[model samples]
Target: MSNNVLFDVPGPRARRTSRIASIVTSVVIVGGLFYLYLALEAPRVTANGTETPGMFDPTRWDVITDGRMWNAILVRGLLLGTLKMAAVAAVFALLIGVIFSFARTARSKWIRIPAAVLLDFFRGMPVLLLMLFILLIIGPGAYWAGVAGLAIYNGAVIGEALRSGIQSLPKGQRESGLAIGLTPVQTRLIVEFPQAFRQMLPIIIAQLVVLLKDTSLAYIIAYPELLNIGLRQLPTTYGNRYFFTFFFIVLIVYLTVNLLLSWVARIVARRTASGRKTRRTGPTAGKDEKVGVDTAAMNAVMPDSS
Candidate 1:
C-alpha cells in the first residue's frame, strides 16, 4: 500500500516479469563483454608481419615495468599537467560561479538581464569551441586558453545550479532577513547565498569532477596535459605498440579520481544533513533555563503586585 503517485506498485506477476527481464539483461551484458574479450584476444597481423593478439602481448605491457615510464606518465603528466590545470581552473570557476550567481540574482534588471544572457551564451557554447576561440586570441598558450574556456563555461553552469538552489528556498528566508533590517544585497550575501551554496554543494562538486574530465579536451589545443602526454608522447617514446597500455593507465586514473570526488560529495551531503538535524533539535536544550530566567525577571519587575 505505497502512496507513491509516480507509478503503480508491481503485482506478483509483474514482479516475476521484472526479475526475468533483469536476469536476461545481465546475461546479455556478460555475454557481450565475453565476446569483446575473445575478439581482442584473437590473433592479428602486425605492421611488421608478426601475428599475435596485441591485447595479450607482453611487449606492449612491458613499458609499465619501467620506472621512467611511470615517472613520465603519472608524475609529470598526471600530477603536474592535468591536476595542476584542473586545480587552477576549479578555483577560477568557483569564483566566477559565485559572482555570476550574485549578478543573476540581483534586483536590478540591468545587472540580472545581462548576466542571464551572458550565462546562457556560455552555457550553450561547446567547451572545445570556447578553448579554440581563446587559443586564437591568446596565441600559443594552450594552457591558459583551456583554463579560461573551462572556467567560463563551467562557471555559467554552476551559477545556474546555485540560482536554482536559492530559488527553491522558502520565500520566508529572504523576507526574514529583510525584516531584520538587512538590505536586499546583505540578505542575499549573508543569509540566502550561504544556505543556497550549502544546499547545492554536492552538485557543485559533481560539476567539478566533470570539469576535471574536460581537461582532456585540452589535448586538441596542444596543451601538454595528461592525455597529450600519456596518449601521444608516451606512446611515441615507448613505441606505438604500447599505446593501449598507456590508454588503459589513463582510463584507470580518470575513473579513480572521479570516484573519489563522488565519494567526497556523498560524505559532504551526509554531514550537511546531520548538521541540519542538530540545529533543528538544539533550541529545546536551553528552553527550561530561558523560561526560568524570564519568570525571575518578570517577578522582579512586578514588585509589590505579587
Candidate 2:
C-alpha cells in the first residue's frame, strides 16, 4: 500500500467501501436523470385548452434554429448586455483592487485602517443586496447598478488576495529592494506588486468568473442580460413552450465562458511559472547578479554612499 501525507492510504476494506459508495452515487444520479427525461417526455396541457408538446419534442426546440432568435439572444442579450457589463465591471474591479491593495498595504495606520474597514464592508455585503441598493439610488439604470455592485465586491476580494500574495513572499525580497537603495514605495511598486499579481492571478481570474456569472442577477433589476432575455423576453416573443430550451442555452453559454476563463488562467499561470524557472536557471544561472530587479537603476537615483 502507498503512504500519503494528507490522509491515510485506503486499506482493502476501505477501498471496497469507497468503490461501493461511488457506485451507489453514480446509480442514484443516473436514475434521477432517467426520471427527469421521462417527466419531460410526458405531455402537458395549457390554460387555453390546447395540448402542448413535451420539452424533449423536436418542434419545441425549433426556435433555436432561427437566425433572428440567435441574433436577439446571442448578439443583443449576451454580447451587448452580459459580456459588456462583465467587461466593464472587470476593468473597474481591477482598478479598484489595485487602489485598495495599495491602501491596505500602506505604512500609515490612518490609511490602512479605513481601507480595511471599507474592504470588510464591501466583502461582507451580499452582492444582490448591493445591486438593489445601487438600483434604488441610481433610479432605473440596471446596467450601472449591477456594474458598480460587482466592481466594489469583487474589488475588495481581489485586493485581499493581492495583499496576501505580497505578504507571503520571503522577507528577503523586500530587504533586497531596500539594500539596492530603493525607496520603500519604489520597491513595492517596481518589485513586489508585479510578483504578487502573478502569484494571485489564479484567484483574481476565479473572482472575475464569479463576477461574470453574477451578471445574471441584473435580471432582477430588469436588465436584458442573458438570463433575462432567455427567461422572459424570448418566451414572450416566441412562446412559453421553448422556456426550457432557452434556459438550457443560457446555462451552456455561462458554463462555456467561465470554463474558457479558467483555461486561460491555467495557461497564464503555467507560462509565468516557466518564465520564473528560466530566469533562475538560464545561461547566467551561476552569475552573482539579480535576475529580475534592476539595481543600477536604483543606484542612479540614489546618493552615493562613501
Candidate 3:
C-alpha cells in the first residue's frame, strides 16, 4: 500500500543487528573513557615525600572555587584581556578583509595581482609565527602586536572567504548587470556584493571563531590573556602538579566562546536562507522595478492605436 521506494525499510533482523552494534560501540566508548580517567587520575610521588596531585585532585581545583581568586583574576583580568584583544583584532580584520577583497576583485591586474599575493602569503604563514614576529618587531607586552598579527593573518583568510563567495555567484548576475549598462565596478558593488555577503556570512563567522581562539597565542608575547594568566597561576596554585587541570579550564573557555559563535552563525544562516527563499518565491523585491517610459509617440505611430 505504501509508495516510498528510495530506501528499503529495515527488517526485524536488521534492526536487531543495528541495536546490537550500537550497544557494542557505546560499551567500547565508555570503557575507553574510564581507562583514560584511571590513567590521568594517577598521582605521582614528589621529592618531598608528598603525593603530587593529578587532574582529579581536589586541591588543584580550589582556585576555580575560591570566589576571590576566581572572580578577581580569571574573570576580571585575563578573560577581559582576551576578549578585548580579540574584539580589536576582529574589527580590524573585517575592515582589512573588505578592502583586500575589493582589491582582489578589482578591474586592474596591478591591484588584483598584489592583493592575491598578499592574501596568499598571510594565509600561508602560521598565525603563531606571525604573532611572534610582530611581537619582536614591536616589543614585549605591547598588546597591539597581538592585534596586528591576528588581524593581518585573519584578514587575509576573510578576504579569501569573501572573494570565493563573490566568485561563486552566478555568471548571469555579472552579465545581466553589464547588460544593463552598469560598469564592472558598479555592477559588483551594487548588484553582487550584498548577495555574496549573505552567502558567505557563515564562513566569515567561523573565521571569527578561529580568530577568538588564536587570541590565546597572545600568551607567548606575555600579554595577560586567559591562558597566560592560567599558566602563571599554575605554579603557585597547583604547584605545577595539575597542568592538565589548568589547561582543561582554558580549553573549556575557548570551547564555550567558539560554541556561541557557531550558534550565532547557524542563526544567521537560517535567516539568510529563509530570506533567499522568500525572494525566490514571492514578488521580486524591487529587482523588477523599472522607470516609466513615454508612450504618446509610439501610440500615435501604431496602426492599431487606441
Q: Worst lDDT window (10 residues) for model 2?
A: 297-306
The worst-scoring run of ten residues by lDDT in candidate 3 lies at: 297-306
* TM-scores for every candidate against the unseen true structure: 0.81, 0.81, 0.80
What is candidate 1's lDDT per residue for 1-306, written digit by digit as tens? 555576788899988998999999999999999999888767788799988655757777878889998888788888988999899999999999999988988889999999999988888788999999999976649999999999998888888777776766667779999999999989999988988888777667878888898999999999998899999999888788788788899899888988898899889878776765675577554433221112332232122111
lDDT of model 3, residue 205: 79
Ordering by lDDT: 2, 1, 3
Residue pairs with colliding backbones in model 1 are none
- Model 2 C-alpha RMSD vs. true structure (Å) is 8.9
lDDT winner between candidates 2 and 3: 2
Q: Per-residue lDDT tens digits of candidate 3, residues 1-306?
A: 563475589889988998999999999999999999988788878799998766787876765776765553467545677888989999999989888889999889999999999888888788888888877876645588889999998888777777776766667788999999999989998988877777667667777878888888888777888887766755465567556666787777777877888899889878876776676565654544321111342222121111
What digit string (tens of lDDT, one per residue) describes model 2 on residues 63-112? 87899989888898999999999999999999999999899999999999
Candidate 3 Cα errors over 4 Å, as ranges: 1-7, 46-49, 72-78, 138-141, 171-187, 282-306
The lDDT for every candidate, in the order shown, is 0.81, 0.83, 0.75
Write down the RMSD of candidate 1 (Cα, Å).
12.6
